[model samples]
Target: MRLPTLASTVERRLLVNYRVDPPAISRLLPAALRPQLVAGYAVAGICLIRLGNVRPTWAPKAVGLRSENAAHRIAVEWDGPDGIQTGVYIPRRDTGSRLNTWAGGRIFPGEHHIADFQVHETGKELHVSYTTRDDATRVEIAATVDDDLHDSRLFSNLEQVSAFFRRGSAGYSATKTGHHLDGMRLDTRRWQVTACQAQRATSTFFENPDRFPPGAATFDCALLMRDIPARWHSLPAMPVETDVSGSVPSDARM
Candidate 1:
């Protein structure tokens, strides 16, 4: 009897669902503090908040700057049923100065999925872009911030945030989890992925400490599989629950 030889196989992909764009470098810093804060973008659902700031150890006063100042803040909220997502920008010269506050809730109607967001600097302008999917509807948005602004701190921070979503929780209530990444700390309950497709989609909750000073700021992002037996209407009509104690969800079991 003759035996046949077997071939070995290698899997090239990792199990992680997140993908990060290469960190972009810039010389847009003051001469003395140039080595401290390195500017870059991180992608999450619908584009997470971008950031540009000096390192924690570098005191703003060392460069004749104040820590209590913000150049501007741009906020975008989606309302699923109304078929519109609204964005607002507030410019602040001093930290004590307050921008117009926005309440948290659904900002747009019929929004099913949101992703592919980026914020970049072009000369003196700041640009932001994102894609929204509402049921059978699809739309893309690109906006720019072009005003003579000497505040690099606010611009640096805004340039660091980006987001992407796999599934649509159109009416789900988001919980907060207390966590921090880089200088940004998230203080809220954590969200768990319930019914994700091909392990590409997962749910996460984050709170941006820099933007929401005293109160906690929170948002959600996830990756979704392209095609499967699942339809937008096949999912449950209930909101996914959050684990305040960091317990894993039962639905996450494969």
Candidate 2:
């Protein structure tokens, strides 16, 4: 779905990150992309975001839509015209809004699976979960705001972690066609993240033994952002080699 520049309010966004063995990560990415490592481990994660007032740049706030969404992503680097470029490669996207599901890959930049979402947020605590229509993907996370990142093996402080993700604003998503990847860039007016302690977190994709193996991926930390204005801009699709299709799951056919 082609669209003009989109604007939205990031009501809440939670990033649950993991550090995975590079070998495991490589097997999942397409040939055009490779894992972008940090502190030697490949970074992968889930982004659970709730968007408000999502509409075309010129649309009024009242005409906007609100939706709960999630993306299973891996930090990756690829050779671009400029040089080596960094971004996150999204293998799958799920959304609670039927409009989003229908528009995905047509109006939106990526294909989205329809899912039922459950989100409960309080002053300092949060619980988010979702199950896709086909039941192939499920995620559950319970967390609370924290003052700092204390146990992350990937970074020492919050500033370091925030900067790391900020650079990865560009994202490419897998499409069913398998010929090319849809691209999008998230430009936020203010970039801010808070340290969060994940009391419990689980992702079917990251935890799948067939994909990540038992010791291949480990939970690192979580970050939270709220009430930030952001824009989503579409980019030219990146072509993919025919042989790369077999590397991703059948549902995503990257």
Q: Model 2 — TM-score against the truth?
A: 0.96
Query: Please, what is the whole-model Cα lDDT of each candidate in the order they appear?
Result: 0.21, 0.91
TM-score, one value per model: 0.17, 0.96
Off by over 4 Å in 2: 244-254
* Local lDDT at 199 for model 1: 14
Which tens-of-lDDT digit does each residue in 171-190 have in candidate 1? 22211221100011111122
Candidate 1 TM-score to native:
0.17
Most accurate candidate by TM-score: 2
Q: Candidate 1: minimum summed lDDT over ten consecutive residues — where?
A: 6-15
